[model samples]
Target: MENYLNALLTDVMLKEEEIGDICDKACEILLNEPNMVNVPSPVLICGDIHGQYYDLLTIFKINGTPKSRKYIFLGDYVDRGANGLECFCLLLVYKIMYPSNIFLIRGNHESKDLTKIYGFYDEVAKKYGNSRVWRYCCDVFECLINACLVNGRIFCVHGGLSPSLLDIDEINRIYRLNKLPDNHFVNDLMWSDPDELNPGFSKNSRGAGYTFGSEVTKKFLEINNLTMLVRSHQLAFTGYQMHFKEKCAVTVWSAPNYCYRCGNLASVLRVDENDITGKNFLIFKDTPQKPSSVGLPGYFL
Candidate 1:
């Protein structure tokens, strides 16, 4: 496992069979987790990677690797960038190797519906010469946990609050057996965004979920007795954005220079052990240049 991780970090490509084995192992691990997972604090919370493999590597460089620090990735691991397969595979490798230290939640882009339109599908098909690896990955995506509770106080998810979610129990009861659905609580959990302009729920421009306001966020936090809601779905020029007057909700974007053109910074939220109020925001910029192919495959370019 260490060898595989090193190879990926250095821009080396794994064989097709290796990817299949890794996906199989990841699926087995994810199947055992419930819809709402409980993770501990002293864990680093990160948002979307979107196939930016080099930037993902930079994240590790700035915040340490998963082996050294606990992490909860809020999803959108694939699609958009040039190396989605490598980015996703590296994360899966970490999850398989350190199941207890790492937690992953589903994002809207994890769905088969979105990947087909985005860049993930073509990247995999082009690299592997078949759809077998892509299919296996989709299977694993179905089992990804939707939300995580850190020390039973902080709520972590890919997107913001949902209208149908009154409590964390409702999140655990969701049946995420297929691709994300429109107009469904599961979809909202992974697709919704927080709105500061509106005072209540309003239709999202994305046409899938609602944009909740500060009142809605406050109500959700109070009802759940949660200190804060940490999520990632929207981009922040400064890498993270804090909403609600009390800093009850935050959006952390980990993909710097999103889509290789947004010129946006990225950040990760580090919560110390037994200190829910101590959120250390670590900011990072994109790599000066993309990593060289080196031992990578010919198709990497």
Candidate 2:
């Protein structure tokens, strides 16, 4: 029995190693690929895929391939939507296929605890007969993702600024373990949401965590010296929503038919920063095959 267990463990380790090898080779190819991240490149920033595999595929069809342009996925690649496993697998394949053009970040749903509750764990177990594939794919996710980045002038994260994160690199230092432990700040970073800008803590409507106000966002931005906070969390009927009017923060929601029937349009943001003085955005909207029966909220459109 001991030998058998040892062999099984060794097999898992070897499979993990092979996955890493494929990803590394892909990253190398991306590095050699010419002008992948050059200026004027239209950077495609997508919000929560939530395992909506067909919609994700449709996005690829509309936007062309990630190889042709820069792609930044703001996490939550799994859960709620059917095909969570497929969505994750396809992303891993893409990460290997176009390592240079794609940049993935960690999302709240990516955690094991969240997946277990939100359908991804069950989906994988149902499809694969166990958690092996889910485990494997998640390992790939943590290693391949960058938590947050100070991209020129904007600070990008899966969620928005946490009152705790004073420096951007503090986010980078968040080590990715196979599974998240309870009460960790990084866990909070992944799971927290900023719905309304209140100075005090309010219960998160989504049942995730506390709601943050403009004061937190303001202080966070002021301390970090960031001109804008670009994040993906909370659903927006129009796919992108701006807040504070004065502060340059924006939330880009990409999943359409979100939560199965939120009736929101799928969206993405394309920023052309080549001319620094005159930066502009090209917002892409996905009008689904079936028009949403409900109307968008006032703030979203």
Tell me how far the alpha carbon of residue 70 in candidate 2 is from the true structure, in angstroms, after superposition: 0.7
Q: In model 2, where is the ten-residue run with the lowest total lDDT?
A: 289-298
Q: Pairing residues by index, what is the TM-score of model 2? A: 0.74
TM-score of each: 0.94, 0.74
Question: By lDDT, who's the top model here?
Answer: 1
| Residue pairs that clash (backbone atoms under 3 angstroms), model 1 | none
Q: Write the per-residue lDDT of candidate 1 for residues 1-301, one digit (tens) a residue.
A: 7888888877777887888888888988987888888888788899999988888888888888888889999999998887888888899999999888888899989978899999789888877678887887888788788998988889888988788777778877656785445677888888899887886888889988889998988888889888888999888999999886777889999999998899999998889988676368999999865643444457655
- Tell me, what's the RMSD of every candidate? 1.9, 10.5
Off by over 4 Å in 2: 1-41, 144-146, 178-181, 195-197, 200-209, 275-301
State the TM-score for model 1: 0.94
